[model samples]
Target: MKPFWIYYQKEMLEASRTYKWIWVPAVFLLLGIMQPVSTYYLPEILTMSGEVPPEAAALFTIPSADSVMASTLSQFSTIGLLVLVLAGMNTVAGERATGTAELVLTRTVSTLPMMGAKWAAMMTLMLVSFALGLAGAAYYTHQLIGPLEWGAVASGGLLYAVWLAWIVTLVLPLGAVLRGPAAAFISLGTAAALSLLSGLLPSRFQWSPGRLSSMAAEWMLGAGAGAWAPVIAALLIMLLSIIAAAGLLRRSPLSPQS
Candidate 1:
């Protein structure tokens, strides 16, 4: 237990030194704030370009606050997700690439605690960044769009965070064997495929973690009923990812040089 906290602290310090703690949260906050700001200013923006007719501009209406907040989550779903995956892609892989893992593994009895610490540190960053982003989106939505239900926002944000967690967790095990970029690419590809499959076959993929983004939106809109399946599935997947990462690390603590 003490070792776990030590590893976790090390990971946090590493993140700070790498400037990840700053840029990742900044990106999320920017993405979140931009959604509502852009949506609110769309009519004027289009008019300034002279490409939109007055009648067309008049037809534009601000969406509901809930809808704007949901759109903010969608923003996180794309670029925000990409940023997070890229930031975490090298976590384990870099250590191995630099021979840091070899040193760490020699001092540890099992790789599980180290892996767990890495995952926890990643989650800490994710949660703090997401919360800031969500808060910014909610504030702008309230000021520019309409009032929002704080309860719904909190619940929906948790669901969305869970969705992001599983996808980000993929880099752990993947990085154990693959290069950093390869791990990130495959993690993103897997997320894309799952999202596409879930969209195409809603009934079949009801328990899919990919459905979490939409479920989050629905929950924010006050229509997310019976969404426990995907939430549970996502949590299970994260656990499995950690365990797999530990085993993979135990087997191959250092990455093969190119």
Candidate 2:
């Protein structure tokens, strides 16, 4: 437990040193604010561009607040997910690349504790960034759009966070076996494929983590059904990823090729 906290603190400090603590959350907040703000100003924007006729501009109406919030989640699903994966892609691989993992292991801290700490730190960043972004989106949506149900907002955010979690967790095991960039690419590719499959066959892929984004949107819209299956599957996948990362690190603490 002590070792885990120590490593967790080290990971947090590393994030701070790298300025990830600043940029990641700032990007998320920007992305979140952009959605509602853009949606609110679409008619004016179109008018300024002179692309749409005056008649067409008059036909435009702001979407419902719930829809705007859901759209904000969609924005997070793409760019936000990429940002998180890139931020965490090197969590393990970078350590190995710099010989830091080997040095840390020499201190008698086993692979599991170290891996657990890395996972926890990455999650902490993800949660904090997401929360900030969601809050920003909600606040803007309320002021520029309409009131929101705080209960649905919280529930929807949790579901979206889980969706983000499993994808980010992919970096752990993938990074243990691949270079940082390659690991990030593969993690994103996997997410894309799953999301594509889930969209193409909603009935067949009901339990897929890919459904999490849409599920979150539906939940926010008050049309959500219970989706325990995908939640459970996501939890299982995260657990397996941690275990696989630990095993891979134990075998090769210095580098993937090693």
Q: Summarize candidate 2's per-residue lDDT along 111-230 as a digit string, tens digits.
A: 888889999999999999999999999999999999999889999999999999999999999999888999999999999999999999999998999899889999999888988999
User: Poorest 10 consecutive residues of model 2 by lDDT?
Assistant: 249-258
Q: Against the hidden reference, what TM-scores do the models get?
A: 0.98, 0.97
Clashes of each: 0, 0
Candidate 1 lDDT (Cα, 0 to 1):
0.93
| Candidate 2 wrong stretches, greater than 4 Å | 256-258
Predicted candidate 1 versus true structure: per-residue lDDT over 150-173, tens digit per residue: 999999999999999999999999
Model 1 regions lying over 4 Å from their true place: none
Displacement of the residue 178 alpha carbon in candidate 1, Å: 0.8
Most accurate candidate by TM-score: 1
